[model samples]
Target: MRIYISADMEGVTGLVDRDDVQPGGRDYERGRRMMALDVNAAVRGAVAAGASDVLVNDAHGPMRNLLPEDLHPAARLIRGRPKQMGMLEGLVAAHDAMICVGYHARAGALGVLSHSFMGHEIEDMWLDGRPVGETGLAQATAAAIGVPVVALTGDDVACAEATDWDPSITAVAVKYATDRFAAELRPEDDARQAIEDAVSAALAAPLAVPEPAAGPAVLEVRWQSASVPATLAGLPGVTATDSRTVRAEGELPALYRQFGVWMRVATALTNQPPYC
Candidate 1:
């Protein structure tokens, strides 16, 4: 079976602050190594579970957090940004399953370093009228592509979020949140082992891929700045929901791509540190 892994940094083992995940921060180097190790654990599990191929997507900010040299040799990496699908880049229907590693909870959640696609620019997001964070959106997009998200690794809050979105997914929590930037972390070895074991068991008997959605999908975003919505409104099929919000309608994957464009536009217009 072919497997895809999307790796984000915030919920990575032992990372509880932006300093750890963002470039130029004192601990960013250590954080990236930690991120790669978590992904490697998943890669090892996938290979042991009979995966013939594995693709890893560096799905955090700047999209260059994972170095090719640091990843498991069995896994090929999708690194860099401007990817149409953002965090879900390199994901396709042909992949048997997708595993999300080191993902945090949605914006405003108490999970460590929790935020949506953007640090604070995106206030909230809704897909098909259901509130969703990275977890839900990724799962929805994979489902639309006829791929199942078999497992996820993150903080306790992120794990709970994933389970709430789809109980079939196996979620392994490496930390328990005390605040957005504070967590009670598990030992690195213990956390990695949990990730590896959970991924192996989940992929051993993967869930059936859902049928691709036949109807149009709606994506709505509430931005922190009104200028973002005003600017995004100029895009075709995008409607201004209010002063600080915009809504778009299209099919899945396409809708997902449009959201990426909207984020880039917002990033260009705003100048604020993430998690501010």
Candidate 2:
């Protein structure tokens, strides 16, 4: 069996503040190592579960966070990007199941460091009129490519959100969110063990592909600033619903591509300082 794992940092064990996820922040190294550990745990689990192939996607910012020397020898890692699927990159027909490691809850969720893609500018995201977070979007992307999201590891809120998307999905919460930036963390070793066990069990089960949404998917992004949405209004099939909301209607794959474009545009606009 082949398993795909998407790893993000904010929901990794013991990470609570923005500094932990930022590249230059004092805790960034710790966060990166913890994320690598978490991914390795999942890799071990998949191996133990009889998976013949495992692919780990560094899905966080810049898409190049995992330490190559420290990663599990059995698993291959996908790093860097501009890929068609952002977090869900490298997903293909051969992957039997998918797991999201260290995933947080949606933007504005109670989970620690909660935010969807482009946390700095996007207020929230909705699919087919229902609000969904990164995990949901990731699940949809997996489904579009015919892979089931069999398991996920994150904080309490993220696990709950996963279950809401697919109740049968196995979930391991490494921490319990006290709020957006604080959590009562489970010990690092304990969290790793739990992830390993949960992943093993999830992979052992029958593939339960999430039911795809009926009809064309409509994705709406609510921006932190009205100007951001306005700027995206001219894109084909993208409509500025209001001052702060942009809606894109199309097949799931197409919509996802558009979302990636918006994220890159907005991130570029906000992450730079004026030249003069």
Candidate 3:
């Protein structure tokens, strides 16, 4: 079986603040190492579960966080940005399953370093009228292409969010959130072990790939800046929901790609840092 792993930094084993995940932060180097370790654990699990191929995507900010030399030898890495699918880049129907590693919660959530695609720029998002976050969006996109999200690893809040999106996904919480930038972390070794074991068990079982939506999915985003929506409204099929929000309709993966365009537009118009 082929396994795809999307690795994000915020919810990695011991990260809790922007300083931990952002490039210039004092602990960013250490954080990236931690990120790689968490991903390696997932890679090891996928291999143990009979995966014939493994692809790991660096899905965090910059998309260059995971070092090629640090990744497990069993896995190939997709790093860097401008990817059409963003976090879900390199994911396709041919992959048997996808595993999300070190993902945080949605914007305004209490999980460590919680934020949506563009940090403060995106206030909230809805997929088919259900409040959605990174975890939900990724899961939905993968399902659209016939790939099952078999497991996820993150903080307690992120794990709960995953369960809310799809209970069948095995969620391994590496930390318990105390606040947005704070958490009661599990020891690194213990957390990695949990991630490894959970992923192995999840992949070892029967995987269920949800049927793709029959019709188009509606995507709505409430942005912190009205200019963002105003700018995104220019995109085909995108409409201004309000001064600060926009909505669009399209098929899965395609809709997912459109959202990436929205983010780029917002990034060009906003100057706020992700954690501000």
Number of the predicted model whose TM-score against the real structure is largest:
3
Q: Candidate 2, residues 28-116: lDDT per residue as tens digits?
A: 88889999999999999999999999999999988878988989999999999887788888888689999999998888777888888
In terms of TM-score, which candidate is stronger, 2 or 3?
3
**Weakest 10 consecutive residues of candidate 3 by summed lDDT:** 206-215
Write out the backbone clash pairs for model 2: none
Error of 1 at 16 (Å): 0.4
CA lDDT scores, all candidates in order: 0.92, 0.86, 0.92
- Comparing 1 with 2 on TM-score, the higher-scoring candidate is 1
TM-score (C-alpha) between model 3 and the true structure: 0.99
Which ranges in model 3 have alpha carbons more than 4 Å from their true place?
none
lDDT of 3 at 15: 94
Q: Give the distance in Å from residue 165's predicted Cα in candidate 3 to where it truly belongs.
A: 0.5
In candidate 1 the C-alpha lDDT for residue 110 amounts to 87
The window of 10 residues in a row where model 2 has the poorest summed lDDT is 267-276
Worst 10 residues of 1 by lDDT: 205-214
RMSD of each: 0.9, 2.7, 0.7
lDDT, candidate 2, residue 21?
Answer: 82
